[model samples]
Target: MSNLLPEEAEEKLVTVCRTAVGDSLRSLTYFNRFDYVQVYLREDLEQEADLNSFIGNEWHDFKMTQDAYRGSELGDYEYTIRVFENGYLVRITVEDFGVFVTTDGISMQDFEALAAATTEILDEWAIEE
Candidate 1:
């Protein structure tokens, strides 16, 4: 698949995610130099689900982790999903940017479906370029 520059990817992610899960999607944050992204979804989930929340301010810690290991591929380019009582979060490194996700009250199944749809859009965007 063709790749996208971090800023380009971040823009696409915002559009894709908004279309995919606008209702449950709380916010989208991307850090290009740090290669970080976050997607926040509404949360109301059960334990042992395929996805889990990061408990407490782990999302903040996550940002710190990205800040700490900014330029290294091994340190920064990993995907993390955290499900908390209020919501869920998805963090990933793409190119030189990072993606973060947060949910306010969405179920696990719905969140996954929305995320899949968002990813599809990103893939398609890459191919188009």
Candidate 2:
């Protein structure tokens, strides 16, 4: 299992996303879990090839629309939640580091909420106090 706490993980994800997209972002709230938030970016599809390449020949169970790509991984003591950014067709992946999130794409408010939710869930499985 991961040693990091959810809060800590979330912080890490925010840093990574911000670094990639920047601090100013646009977002819309479309879905939510107890500690998770689903956001839609305001951007349009930019890189269709790059986005399609990520899901090439891979089996994915989408949660939203047919355009959405989703997957999960379960290990001996680790679990991961992955969501691909469909906005701007930016093939961004949000990974929960047992407590936080890591992703690529432009910054947006929706992304912030997603990062927060991912961290909250990871916190429950942290290996660190």
Candidate 3:
């Protein structure tokens, strides 16, 4: 794993995601000094009308738990994919940050491949990661 900066990672993610999702992607934002990339999508009919929507109805169920000092939810309906290269981390949240997926200990190429695959699954929306 090469030591990649957050900006570089963000660029790679955006490219991979764009190739995956095409024009529906809304925004990909970096938070905590690039520790995470919040991937937001437009709430359009294409997204809402899918019976098998990857991002499910529990989109707004995320909440910060005081006991665990973390966020928790109950379904995999929403999707979030987090990517990490070198030691930096990037989190891609889906549907109002509903689902959270985190990835670490991987090469840049592998990370890009993963992002591409995920984008492919989310073909209904555009991604700006």
Candidate 4:
């Protein structure tokens, strides 16, 4: 069903996240330009299955960020964390594919770890340039 990573690969990705922080992870949604798949952990997925549509604007925003901050003194892009009243949303992306995960309150160290793990996996599965 996924155009970027296969089911087994998707499972592995989620497993890695689970292992990293255990039950804190609520859901992970993998998305590209056209399609997406949501793997729920702590909550049942609601009626909306359109993860790509939900994040459509974010994709554009991320691209703008990459272009706007090119060559800045700041180091490489790592992760974006959006705080919600109930939990946290963490997004990690590369040039082609990316994933956003929801988790119960987690520490900054855990956030960095998730971002690193995600980026490594993304490199492994990225399309050949």
13-94, model 4: which lDDT tens digit per residue? Answer: 8987887767899888887777677755465545454565667965777788888888889976767888999888888888
lDDT of 2 by residue, 21-96 (tens): 4633333111112122323233642322332223431213222322342342432222223455633322222232
In lDDT terms, which candidate is top? Answer: 4
What lDDT would candidate 2 get against the real structure? 0.34
Best by TM-score: 4
> In candidate 4, which residue ranges exceed 4 Å CA deviation?
1-4, 43-50, 127-129
User: Ten consecutive residues with minimal summed lDDT in candidate 1?
Assistant: 47-56
Off by over 4 Å in 2: 1-5, 27-129
Better of 3 and 4 by lDDT: 4
Predicted structure 3, TM vs. truth: 0.29
When superposed on Cα atoms, how far off is each prediction in RMSD?
10.2, 12.2, 14.2, 2.1
Clashes of each: 34, 11, 7, 0
For residues 1-129, write the lDDT of model 3, one tens digit per residue. Answer: 223234555455556655544443444433221133344433441333232232232232222222233345653332333333423223344432322223325455654554546545333333543
Candidate 4 positional error at 122, Å: 0.5
Measured by C-alpha RMSD in angstroms, how accurate is candidate 4? 2.1
Q: lDDT of each model, Cα atoms only? A: 0.54, 0.34, 0.38, 0.79
